[model samples]
Target: MRTLAAIVLICTATAPQAHPHIFIDTGLTAIVDDAGALQAVKVTWAYDAFYSLLITEDYGLDPDGNAVLTPDEEAQLRGFDMQWIEGFDGDLVARLDGGSLELSRPRDVTLVMREGRLVTTHVRDVAGTPAMAGHILSMKPFDPTYYTSYDVTMNVRVQGLEGCAIVRNLPDLDAGMQQLQGALTKLGRDQDAIEEGFPEVGEAFATEVEITCADR
Candidate 1:
């Protein structure tokens, strides 16, 4: 069967957007530290992807400021908190039904770059969004802790991603399960997950993403 690269990313860098958005990169290095009672993490970042897709819209801005939208696109953006954050838990719970899925709350995440590498940053205070909810169910969770951050590991196995999986030699949903297990460990611990998949650019199935965390 044909399968495509899974886990796509289409995010682009611009000035600080009004709505909540985070940075993604591979050029980064992080230091594990303690913030009083809470876990504190510092990160350096590497963002080099040409473009990125916004899972949600920047509702805070007006139509003129926004890139513009079609009737259908506008409808999708109409209801919801419409920020980088998930509008509701149902978004996640719904995905759990089909394939395997898991979410986590880690102590802290940071960007790190040892020796000489690109800037890679961790997804701090972030939650996982569905790549292709229609094709696969069960996504790697996007934690509120990394709500405004990026991650290197992204989850798949949702109904939405079936399109890509069908067109390319992608890993089976079984692999998606293995990825979920790793994300669980990352939630509360100061660990890193660099889940591999396709970037969301050329193909339609490249919608989900997990930006990496590393040092420049």
Candidate 2:
């Protein structure tokens, strides 16, 4: 059985990978300090059942296993640090006050199996929290290479604040279809190269989140 780490390595090794070999339902929560200032964003990614199964099988979990992790297993899982390559801005993209925020690497990483699904989480601190009384913060998680698909769960929630709301943007179908057409045209009947060259096309398309807090 292959381990979960091996799966990640395999995905990365294959260049120009077709869009979305792995699917994730992602969520973001804003954390606030005692003064009600935003401190960091909590990002949670839950793998789909199929991918979870692959991971469980690799981890030697039984087919009927409920996906629970023992302490040692948990540690091993956590040790599979999922850091971005050096100088990579990371998959979680965000902007504060119309300026892109350079998020720090995720800290407090943890992984767990829940209801047969693999869920991982971490916190990315805001470079600096400004007085955001009337500011709008927008975020989206996407792979420019389109190798993985990220979607926000319906249960998205805000923690440590009362006046905050999340406004989600749906995908632009016309644009996406156009992008697909372009990629297909560029491939020029080289079906095999699609997976190896599509990475250069860039922009995997994403659902944006607008986080708003009422004046406070």
Best by TM-score: 2
In order of listing, the candidates' clash counts read 82, 1
Point to the candidate with the largest lDDT. Answer: 2
User: Which pairs clash (backbone N, Cα, C closer than 3 Å) in model 2?
Assistant: 16-195
Please write out the lDDT profile of model 1 over residues 77-178, one tens digit for every residue.
432321234444312212223543333323233322222222322323223432332232212222232222233232221111122331112234344333
Each model's TM-score, in the order given? 0.21, 0.79
TM-score of 1: 0.21
Candidate 2 residue lDDT tens string, 1-216: 013223433543432333456777888887767566768888888887778878768867544666666667666666353757787765788887788877888888988877777788989888776544467888888767655667776355556667777798866645654564466455444355544455432343577888887877
Residue ranges of candidate 1 with Cα displaced over 4 Å: 1-46, 49-107, 114-203, 207-216
Q: Tell me how candidate 1 scores on lDDT.
A: 0.27
In candidate 2, stretches whose alpha carbon ends up further than 4 angstroms from where it belongs are 1-17, 59-68, 79-81, 188-196, 200-204
**What are the lDDT figures for the candidates, one per model?**
0.27, 0.67
